[model samples]
Target: MWLKRFGGGCSREKLRSILETPDGELIIVGGKSHGNNQYKCTFEFYDDAWILKVDADNGAKIWEKTYGGRNYEHFEDIVKNPNGGYYAIGTACNKKNPPWGGDYCAKNKSALWMKFDDSGNSLGKKHFTNGPNQTGFSITNTSSGGTAWVGESKKLVGSKWQYKAIFYKLTGTKVNYSKVVDLGGWNATSIELTKDGGFIIAAGKNVFKTDSDMKIPALEK
Candidate 1:
């Protein structure tokens, strides 16, 4: 067993996720604050989302990068794609002009997705925001060179604010299937592609399965 440290020089960095690449390297994703941002928070950086590739054997930094110009952006989940790129989901507070092509945000927070090549280059980005406090927590690879993410969406359900679990399937940055589950779970924290052509998701206190289209009975609540 070995332990290694990253981020230095008076900067505050917090790691959010890590994945092993096909080539046995490590891809670490998190947020970095160059020091002192809006909140005047001292313990951590909440300015930009950070990603880096490092040697798995000895933890030598190969490449490192930080995205999100100024607003608050933090990656909550990440997954390695079959086509050699990486997909990440952000629980972001990017209200205005985001890099992913979204213009309006009903609230201070929104859900985000971004793709990065093996060399850590931005490939594409997408955001899902229907109401207030939208957040995506997990991203997983499904069949057919596609990816999926699970998150929370706050919307009005019959004059009452409800927290819905949102599932989105993407085919190369294009949303092909989406489902808003109003099961009162608050947030979907994890997701996996099942072997039987289905999906399993874990939200606040709910676990359910859905077909490839994210439709049907939701198997079990």
Candidate 2:
């Protein structure tokens, strides 16, 4: 067996997800630290979202790219688009403003989506912020030639705050907020597309199925 090292010489680097291209190439998405090695005690760190393409057979690096602002950026999941490209979803903490343009810094830690061509060239990006602390955890290619993502975010309900599972459908940067299911303070970790074009969400100790519209249909403990 052969092993490969990426983002070498960095104080910290993490591989979050991997996807295989139609041409037998492997795409790795994660976060990597660069420049100063100084660490911080806060949640936001000095990191960037990193995408690496490698030869699947020989495990040799073909190309690598990084995207971020002055603060932190992370990629949690990736999927190949139907148009011979790739989409990566994650969270970003831009210091000045949100990448997609917003006035609040608390919304800086918003859901991020990036599109890249087959050659590892970036196409565009989109950011979503409903409330603070939104993070995209999983993404999948939808049957309608679009994409779907699932994450968790904090939202204010009446006088209290709660965490909710958020889902989104995207078509070329246009995001349709699918559903915001109240998680009762639990966290939504991942999502999968079912054969019937529905979705199965894994939240805390429960796994539930939702219809195509992201409406809860059933639950499994």
lDDT of each: 0.76, 0.77
Clashes by residue pair, model 1:
none
**Error at 175, model 1, angstroms:** 2.0
Q: What is the lDDT of candidate 2?
A: 0.77
For model 1, the superposed segments whose C-alpha errors exceed 4 Å read 8-12, 36-45, 97-106, 155-162, 218-221
Cα RMSD, each candidate: 4.7, 4.6
TM-score of 2: 0.83
**Residue-level error in angstroms, candidate 1, position 21:** 0.8
Question: Local error of candidate 2 at 69, Å?
Answer: 1.6
Candidate 1, residue 170: lDDT:
82
Clashes of 1: 0
- Estimate, for each residue in 1-221, the C-alpha lDDT of model 1 and write its tens digit: 57887775434667889999999999999877644333443343245778999999889999999887545666888898777889999766746643322332334677879999998899988777766678888888876678888888886558777778888888877788877777754778899889876788888888878788665564334
Error of 1 at 62 (Å): 1.4
For residues 113-147, write the lDDT of model 2, one tens digit per residue. 99999987889998887676688999987767778
